[model samples]
Target: MNLLIAFLLTVLLMSGVWLWQRRSGRADWVDAFWAGSIGALAVFYAVFGDGAVEKRVLVALVAGTWSFRLTRHLAVRLAGHEQEDGRYQAMREHWGERAQFWLFVFFMGQALIAWLFSLPAWVVANDPSPAMNVWVILGVVVWFVSLAGESLADRQLSAFRRDPANRGKVCQVGLWRYSRHPNYFFEWLHWFSYPLIAMGAPFQWLAWLGPVLMLLFLYRVTGIPYTEKQSLKSRGDAYREYQRTTSAFIPWPPKD
Candidate 1:
């Protein structure tokens, strides 16, 4: 409980600071800071928490890798970009003058969600089990596969965007040809790896909730749905045609 409280307080306080500093227009910095802080906390827990060295090492390795990659990706994408995230910009427009308050609430909510989503890593790291098992090996393999898939998807999209020939056309080459949101698909797969690694440990089943909640958010909430709507508005018939031929969340052979 203390560990959880510490995590929550740290996130909330940092979010509050970001909220207060919104006047400076540094939301991206706040996002990067949050990621860095989470990475630091993972190391703290791995080293000082009352878990076996092996479990701590595993959790630290997985969580740190994920956090670093995600943070780097976001930082690269948002660097030198002044536009607010579309989701947040929409909220601002909807809320008008009260958008600041809503933004604070939203940031706080994200902080809470981040901590909740990270609970699997926390629990797994703190578990007493010291034995290496098949599940751990499987989890590592899944993590690598998901990481590679997501990286490839990001690269493919970046390359498509960079090519003038592909301007205004939907990306349908490489991984994007199969899944519209290959990055999101691999992200979901990555979470599943957590439960696999932590199987048989206490509260391990609860770890499954992380992936489910993530998929729900991605599919029904603020992920694919909003992004797709924006894409349809921007790309129109091209995006619609791509949608008809490509999977939304899963990677599979493109439809004929």
Candidate 2:
């Protein structure tokens, strides 16, 4: 029943956002709503679902913090945008006359992903364990590190972009110097927190899916591929050099 409610609520939220997207002709709002919806689900599960007070509160805070931060960041970045994201724009060109239908499908896809990603939070929130295990402690530490690292990456990129002189150049400062996509690495790393937080909880195996699937998406589907393509288009040899020297997803010392 709770699961059904979560799914229905997510669908309803996404449906409303889709209407807004249709009116504005910008699909980027899906990203903002994705983060917000996840946070909302965490709070809902924490407050209404079965769990020990401690675990429920912890899950809500941790997940809610991450979710709200991401949502606000995306919202600010996307404010007053009159066009869709480049990724979706490219899709629109490809789909042509069928673009509207396909875009609706895309919105639904994000809605589904939002629900799927909430699974770990759901598990962690319902752990019902009074004990503060070592795994939970480690999870909290990782969450803090990942959140800070992701924020640092965002700031570095934002600062680089703010400098008009750096136009058409790649960001290779701070965390960007080591990894081409430090933000993605930290985002993917964030997923591991749930399994650790729910270490002793039932269906801990399900929590593992967050990290695994997120890694796959970042590596293959939505993260590095499109961003690198855009960089290659704009920065050309500069980006290629960065790619040759920097790690793609992990934070490692640059090769050259």
Best by TM-score: 2
Off by over 4 Å in 2: none
Candidate 1 Cα lDDT to native: 0.80
**Per-residue lDDT of 99-206 in model 2, one digit per residue for the tens?**
878878887888888888988988987887878878889999999999999999999999999999999989999999999999999999898999999997988888
RMSD after CA superposition, every candidate = 1.9, 1.1
Instruction: Pick out the ten consecutive residues of candidate 1 with the lowest summed lDDT.
Output: 25-34
Return the TM-score for each candidate structure: 0.92, 0.97
Name the weakest run of 10 consecutive residues (lDDT summed) in model 2: 80-89
Global lDDT of each candidate? 0.80, 0.89
Clashing pairs in 2: none
Instruction: Please give, for residues 131-224, the per-residue lDDT of candidate 1 as tens digits.
Output: 7899989998998999889889999999999999988888888988889999999989988877988888887887787698889989898789
lDDT of model 1 at position 252: 88
Q: Give the TM-score of candidate 2.
A: 0.97
